[model samples]
Target: MSENSINSARRAALGKFGLGLATIAATGTGNLASAETTPTSPHPVVLDRFDHIVLTVADVERTCEFYVRAIGVKVETFGSGRKALVFGRQKFNLHQLGREIVPHAHRPTPGSVDLCIIASTTVDDVIKHLKAVNVVITEGPVQRTGAMGPIRSVYFRDPDENLIEISNYL
Candidate 1:
Protein backbone atom coordinates (compact mmCIF):
# COMPACT_ATOMS: atom_id res chain seq x y z
CA MET A 1 0.00 0.00 0.00
CA SER A 2 1.05 3.56 -0.54
CA GLU A 3 2.36 5.52 2.47
CA ASN A 4 -0.55 7.96 2.31
CA SER A 5 -3.09 5.14 2.28
CA ILE A 6 -1.40 3.43 5.21
CA ASN A 7 -1.39 6.64 7.22
CA SER A 8 -5.03 7.25 6.44
CA ALA A 9 -5.99 3.75 7.52
CA ARG A 10 -4.07 4.17 10.75
CA ARG A 11 -5.81 7.46 11.41
CA ALA A 12 -9.23 5.98 10.75
CA ALA A 13 -8.50 3.08 13.08
CA LEU A 14 -7.35 5.41 15.82
CA GLY A 15 -10.37 7.65 15.33
CA LYS A 16 -12.73 4.72 15.89
CA PHE A 17 -11.16 4.38 19.37
CA GLY A 18 -11.49 8.15 20.08
CA LEU A 19 -7.78 8.85 19.79
CA GLY A 20 -6.78 11.94 17.84
CA LEU A 21 -4.62 11.20 14.81
CA ALA A 22 -2.38 14.14 15.64
CA THR A 23 -1.69 12.80 19.13
CA ILE A 24 -0.74 9.38 17.82
CA ALA A 25 1.42 10.79 15.06
CA ALA A 26 3.20 13.21 17.38
CA THR A 27 3.88 10.63 20.08
CA GLY A 28 4.95 7.72 17.93
CA THR A 29 4.48 4.29 19.58
CA GLY A 30 7.18 4.52 22.24
CA ASN A 31 5.96 7.66 24.02
CA LEU A 32 2.19 7.50 24.03
CA ALA A 33 0.04 9.76 26.17
CA SER A 34 -0.44 8.80 29.80
CA ALA A 35 -3.23 6.40 30.79
CA GLU A 36 -5.35 9.17 32.31
CA THR A 37 -6.25 10.53 28.89
CA THR A 38 -6.86 7.17 27.23
CA PRO A 39 -10.36 7.13 25.78
CA THR A 40 -12.72 4.22 26.33
CA SER A 41 -14.12 2.80 23.15
CA PRO A 42 -17.47 1.13 22.68
CA HIS A 43 -15.65 -1.85 21.21
CA PRO A 44 -12.35 -1.48 22.94
CA VAL A 45 -9.44 -3.67 21.97
CA VAL A 46 -8.80 -5.99 24.90
CA LEU A 47 -5.25 -7.03 25.62
CA ASP A 48 -4.41 -10.14 27.62
CA ARG A 49 -0.78 -10.01 28.75
CA PHE A 50 2.76 -10.17 27.57
CA ASP A 51 3.70 -13.13 25.39
CA HIS A 52 7.46 -12.65 25.31
CA ILE A 53 10.21 -10.20 26.10
CA VAL A 54 13.54 -9.90 24.25
CA LEU A 55 16.72 -9.14 26.05
CA THR A 56 20.14 -8.44 24.57
CA VAL A 57 22.80 -10.23 26.55
CA ALA A 58 26.56 -10.21 26.38
CA ASP A 59 26.62 -14.02 26.20
CA VAL A 60 23.48 -15.88 25.16
CA GLU A 61 24.58 -19.22 26.64
CA ARG A 62 25.57 -17.75 29.99
CA THR A 63 22.38 -15.70 30.27
CA CYS A 64 20.22 -18.67 29.33
CA GLU A 65 21.93 -20.85 31.92
CA PHE A 66 21.52 -18.19 34.61
CA TYR A 67 17.79 -17.88 34.01
CA VAL A 68 17.34 -21.65 33.92
CA ARG A 69 19.25 -22.29 37.15
CA ALA A 70 18.02 -19.23 39.01
CA ILE A 71 14.41 -18.98 37.83
CA GLY A 72 13.63 -22.58 36.82
CA VAL A 73 12.90 -21.69 33.23
CA LYS A 74 13.81 -24.16 30.48
CA VAL A 75 15.81 -23.19 27.43
CA GLU A 76 14.37 -23.70 23.99
CA THR A 77 15.69 -23.07 20.50
CA PHE A 78 13.72 -21.59 17.67
CA GLY A 79 14.13 -19.92 14.27
CA SER A 80 17.72 -20.35 13.13
CA GLY A 81 19.16 -21.43 16.50
CA ARG A 82 17.94 -18.43 18.46
CA LYS A 83 17.60 -19.23 22.19
CA ALA A 84 14.82 -18.40 24.59
CA LEU A 85 13.99 -19.01 28.23
CA VAL A 86 10.55 -20.51 28.63
CA PHE A 87 8.43 -20.68 31.77
CA GLY A 88 4.75 -20.55 32.59
CA ARG A 89 3.21 -19.02 29.47
CA GLN A 90 5.95 -16.59 28.60
CA LYS A 91 9.43 -16.67 27.12
CA PHE A 92 12.40 -14.33 26.86
CA ASN A 93 14.19 -14.11 23.56
CA LEU A 94 17.94 -13.98 23.84
CA HIS A 95 19.73 -11.67 21.44
CA GLN A 96 23.48 -11.94 21.55
CA LEU A 97 25.56 -8.80 22.03
CA GLY A 98 26.11 -7.01 18.68
CA ARG A 99 23.66 -9.40 17.03
CA GLU A 100 20.27 -7.86 17.78
CA ILE A 101 17.54 -8.05 15.19
CA VAL A 102 16.52 -4.99 13.24
CA PRO A 103 13.78 -2.64 14.58
CA HIS A 104 14.89 -3.43 18.14
CA ALA A 105 14.96 -1.16 21.17
CA HIS A 106 16.51 2.22 20.51
CA ARG A 107 19.41 1.38 22.78
CA PRO A 108 19.43 -2.38 23.15
CA THR A 109 22.30 -2.53 25.55
CA PRO A 110 22.98 -5.46 27.86
CA GLY A 111 22.72 -5.05 31.63
CA SER A 112 20.50 -2.01 31.30
CA VAL A 113 17.11 -3.36 32.30
CA ASP A 114 15.21 -3.79 35.55
CA LEU A 115 12.35 -6.25 35.57
CA CYS A 116 10.04 -7.94 38.05
CA ILE A 117 8.86 -11.54 37.98
CA ILE A 118 6.05 -12.85 40.12
CA ALA A 119 6.64 -15.99 42.13
CA SER A 120 4.05 -18.58 43.15
CA THR A 121 5.96 -19.62 46.24
CA THR A 122 6.55 -17.59 49.34
CA VAL A 123 9.27 -14.96 49.33
CA ASP A 124 11.18 -16.87 52.00
CA ASP A 125 11.23 -19.98 49.88
CA VAL A 126 12.30 -17.92 46.90
CA ILE A 127 15.23 -16.65 48.92
CA LYS A 128 16.21 -20.20 49.81
CA HIS A 129 16.14 -21.20 46.19
CA LEU A 130 18.28 -18.25 45.23
CA LYS A 131 20.88 -19.20 47.80
CA ALA A 132 20.86 -22.78 46.62
CA VAL A 133 21.59 -21.54 43.11
CA ASN A 134 24.43 -19.36 44.38
CA VAL A 135 22.61 -16.16 43.41
CA VAL A 136 23.19 -13.32 45.82
CA ILE A 137 20.34 -11.20 47.10
CA THR A 138 20.84 -7.50 46.63
CA GLU A 139 17.87 -6.30 48.69
CA GLY A 140 14.32 -6.75 49.89
CA PRO A 141 11.74 -9.22 51.20
CA VAL A 142 9.98 -5.98 51.97
CA GLN A 143 6.42 -4.97 51.16
CA ARG A 144 5.72 -3.12 47.95
CA THR A 145 2.63 -2.25 45.97
CA GLY A 146 2.08 -4.37 42.90
CA ALA A 147 -0.54 -4.08 40.20
CA MET A 148 -2.80 -6.51 42.08
CA GLY A 149 -1.98 -5.35 45.62
CA PRO A 150 0.65 -5.79 48.33
CA ILE A 151 3.63 -7.88 47.35
CA ARG A 152 6.66 -9.26 49.20
CA SER A 153 9.72 -8.87 47.01
CA VAL A 154 13.42 -9.67 46.95
CA TYR A 155 15.83 -8.01 44.59
CA PHE A 156 18.85 -9.46 42.88
CA ARG A 157 20.98 -8.90 39.81
CA ASP A 158 20.98 -11.30 36.92
CA PRO A 159 24.26 -12.39 35.39
CA ASP A 160 24.14 -9.42 33.02
CA GLU A 161 23.52 -6.97 35.87
CA ASN A 162 19.81 -6.52 35.16
CA LEU A 163 18.00 -5.85 38.40
CA ILE A 164 15.42 -8.59 38.89
CA GLU A 165 12.71 -8.47 41.49
CA ILE A 166 11.02 -11.69 42.54
CA SER A 167 7.72 -11.04 44.25
CA ASN A 168 4.79 -12.92 45.73
CA TYR A 169 1.44 -11.32 46.43
CA LEU A 170 0.62 -11.09 50.12
Candidate 2:
Protein backbone atom coordinates (compact mmCIF):
# COMPACT_ATOMS: atom_id res chain seq x y z
CA MET A 1 0.00 0.00 0.00
CA SER A 2 1.02 3.62 -0.49
CA GLU A 3 2.53 5.36 2.58
CA ASN A 4 -0.28 7.89 2.66
CA SER A 5 -2.90 5.12 2.52
CA ILE A 6 -1.21 3.27 5.42
CA ASN A 7 -0.94 6.42 7.50
CA SER A 8 -4.60 7.26 6.93
CA ALA A 9 -5.60 3.74 8.01
CA ARG A 10 -3.54 4.08 11.17
CA ARG A 11 -5.12 7.42 11.97
CA ALA A 12 -8.60 6.01 11.40
CA ALA A 13 -7.83 3.08 13.69
CA LEU A 14 -6.67 5.42 16.46
CA GLY A 15 -9.76 7.60 15.97
CA LYS A 16 -11.91 4.69 17.11
CA PHE A 17 -10.62 5.38 20.65
CA GLY A 18 -11.85 9.04 20.44
CA LEU A 19 -8.29 10.33 19.96
CA GLY A 20 -6.52 11.28 16.81
CA LEU A 21 -2.99 10.11 16.03
CA ALA A 22 -1.55 13.54 16.75
CA THR A 23 -3.12 13.68 20.25
CA ILE A 24 -1.84 10.21 21.09
CA ALA A 25 1.66 11.09 19.93
CA ALA A 26 1.81 14.37 21.85
CA THR A 27 0.07 13.38 25.09
CA GLY A 28 1.15 9.75 25.35
CA THR A 29 -1.09 6.76 25.99
CA GLY A 30 -3.32 7.28 29.00
CA ASN A 31 -6.89 6.48 29.98
CA LEU A 32 -9.00 8.40 27.50
CA ALA A 33 -11.58 9.22 30.19
CA SER A 34 -8.92 11.02 32.22
CA ALA A 35 -9.50 14.22 30.27
CA GLU A 36 -13.05 14.50 31.54
CA THR A 37 -12.53 13.01 35.01
CA THR A 38 -9.45 14.96 35.99
CA PRO A 39 -9.98 17.95 38.25
CA THR A 40 -9.35 21.41 36.86
CA SER A 41 -7.46 22.48 39.97
CA PRO A 42 -3.88 21.42 40.48
CA HIS A 43 -3.42 18.24 42.51
CA PRO A 44 -1.77 18.58 45.90
CA VAL A 45 0.57 15.67 45.47
CA VAL A 46 3.43 16.11 43.02
CA LEU A 47 6.45 13.96 42.37
CA ASP A 48 9.63 14.20 40.33
CA ARG A 49 12.64 11.99 39.59
CA PHE A 50 14.02 9.39 41.93
CA ASP A 51 16.36 10.47 44.70
CA HIS A 52 17.43 6.98 45.68
CA ILE A 53 16.33 3.35 45.49
CA VAL A 54 16.62 0.34 47.78
CA LEU A 55 18.00 -3.04 46.83
CA THR A 56 17.27 -5.83 49.21
CA VAL A 57 20.30 -8.09 48.89
CA ALA A 58 21.50 -11.37 50.35
CA ASP A 59 24.82 -9.78 51.18
CA VAL A 60 24.96 -6.02 51.28
CA GLU A 61 28.75 -5.94 51.26
CA ARG A 62 29.00 -8.21 48.24
CA THR A 63 26.42 -6.21 46.31
CA CYS A 64 28.18 -2.97 47.13
CA GLU A 65 31.52 -4.37 46.06
CA PHE A 66 30.18 -5.76 42.82
CA TYR A 67 28.55 -2.44 41.87
CA VAL A 68 31.72 -0.58 42.77
CA ARG A 69 33.82 -2.85 40.58
CA ALA A 70 31.45 -3.16 37.62
CA ILE A 71 29.90 0.29 37.31
CA GLY A 72 32.19 2.63 39.25
CA VAL A 73 29.61 3.52 41.87
CA LYS A 74 30.97 4.77 45.16
CA VAL A 75 30.37 2.60 48.20
CA GLU A 76 29.41 4.78 51.08
CA THR A 77 28.52 4.40 54.73
CA PHE A 78 25.99 6.60 56.45
CA GLY A 79 24.27 6.71 59.81
CA SER A 80 24.48 3.42 61.75
CA GLY A 81 26.93 2.06 59.19
CA ARG A 82 24.20 1.61 56.57
CA LYS A 83 25.63 1.20 53.07
CA ALA A 84 24.68 2.79 49.78
CA LEU A 85 25.97 2.41 46.23
CA VAL A 86 26.03 5.89 44.78
CA PHE A 87 26.33 7.19 41.22
CA GLY A 88 25.50 10.63 39.96
CA ARG A 89 22.55 12.00 41.94
CA GLN A 90 20.99 8.65 42.79
CA LYS A 91 21.99 5.96 45.25
CA PHE A 92 20.98 2.38 45.92
CA ASN A 93 20.54 1.81 49.61
CA LEU A 94 21.52 -1.76 50.47
CA HIS A 95 19.35 -3.79 52.78
CA GLN A 96 20.64 -7.14 53.90
CA LEU A 97 18.33 -10.13 53.51
CA GLY A 98 16.20 -11.04 56.54
CA ARG A 99 17.46 -7.87 58.20
CA GLU A 100 16.17 -5.06 56.04
CA ILE A 101 15.87 -1.61 57.48
CA VAL A 102 12.39 -0.46 58.40
CA PRO A 103 9.90 0.94 55.88
CA HIS A 104 10.90 -1.34 53.00
CA ALA A 105 8.97 -2.73 50.08
CA HIS A 106 6.07 -4.98 51.12
CA ARG A 107 7.66 -7.94 49.32
CA PRO A 108 11.20 -6.82 48.77
CA THR A 109 13.17 -9.56 47.03
CA PRO A 110 16.69 -9.73 45.70
CA GLY A 111 17.37 -10.21 41.99
CA SER A 112 13.89 -9.00 41.11
CA VAL A 113 14.86 -5.87 39.20
CA ASP A 114 15.76 -5.46 35.52
CA LEU A 115 17.20 -1.99 35.82
CA CYS A 116 18.41 0.18 32.94
CA ILE A 117 20.91 2.86 33.88
CA ILE A 118 22.22 5.60 31.61
CA ALA A 119 25.98 5.59 31.42
CA SER A 120 28.11 8.73 31.34
CA THR A 121 30.51 7.17 28.82
CA THR A 122 30.02 5.24 25.58
CA VAL A 123 28.46 1.77 25.42
CA ASP A 124 31.77 0.36 24.15
CA ASP A 125 33.57 1.66 27.24
CA VAL A 126 30.91 0.11 29.46
CA ILE A 127 31.35 -3.25 27.72
CA LYS A 128 35.10 -3.04 28.22
CA HIS A 129 34.69 -2.22 31.91
CA LEU A 130 32.26 -5.11 32.45
CA LYS A 131 34.74 -7.48 30.78
CA ALA A 132 37.58 -6.21 32.93
CA VAL A 133 35.50 -6.81 36.03
CA ASN A 134 34.78 -10.36 34.80
CA VAL A 135 31.09 -9.62 34.52
CA VAL A 136 29.52 -11.74 31.80
CA ILE A 137 27.30 -9.76 29.42
CA THR A 138 24.06 -11.56 28.77
CA GLU A 139 22.76 -9.44 25.88
CA GLY A 140 24.04 -6.44 24.00
CA PRO A 141 25.58 -3.18 23.02
CA VAL A 142 22.78 -2.97 20.49
CA GLN A 143 19.94 -0.61 19.75
CA ARG A 144 17.07 -0.55 22.22
CA THR A 145 14.26 1.84 23.09
CA GLY A 146 15.15 3.78 26.18
CA ALA A 147 12.74 5.95 28.15
CA MET A 148 13.81 9.10 26.35
CA GLY A 149 14.18 7.44 22.93
CA PRO A 150 16.80 5.37 21.05
CA ILE A 151 19.68 3.98 23.10
CA ARG A 152 22.59 1.59 22.77
CA SER A 153 22.79 -0.89 25.62
CA VAL A 154 24.74 -3.74 27.19
CA TYR A 155 23.11 -6.26 29.50
CA PHE A 156 24.66 -8.27 32.31
CA ARG A 157 23.76 -9.91 35.59
CA ASP A 158 24.99 -8.70 38.93
CA PRO A 159 26.06 -10.97 41.78
CA ASP A 160 22.50 -11.73 42.92
CA GLU A 161 21.35 -12.33 39.33
CA ASN A 162 19.67 -8.95 39.03
CA LEU A 163 19.62 -7.90 35.39
CA ILE A 164 21.61 -4.73 34.93
CA GLU A 165 21.51 -2.78 31.71
CA ILE A 166 23.97 -0.01 30.96
CA SER A 167 22.88 2.33 28.19
CA ASN A 168 24.02 5.35 26.24
CA TYR A 169 21.50 7.61 24.54
CA LEU A 170 21.96 7.70 20.80
Task: Count backbone clashes in candidate 1.
Answer: 0
The worst-scoring run of ten residues by lDDT in candidate 2 lies at 16-25
Shift of residue 26 alpha carbon in model 1, Å: 38
Error of 1 at 134 (Å): 1.1
Q: Which stretches of candidate 1 lie over 4 Å from their true place?
A: 1-43
Cα lDDT tens digits, model 2, 1-170, are 86456655654543423342133323543334432344333655423246688998999888988998999999989989999999866799888889988899999899998998877689999898889879999999788865444679999998889999999767
Q: Please give the lDDT score at residue 40 for candidate 1.
A: 46
Q: Scored by CA lDDT, what does every candidate get? A: 0.75, 0.76
- Model 2, stretches more than 4 Å misplaced? 1-44
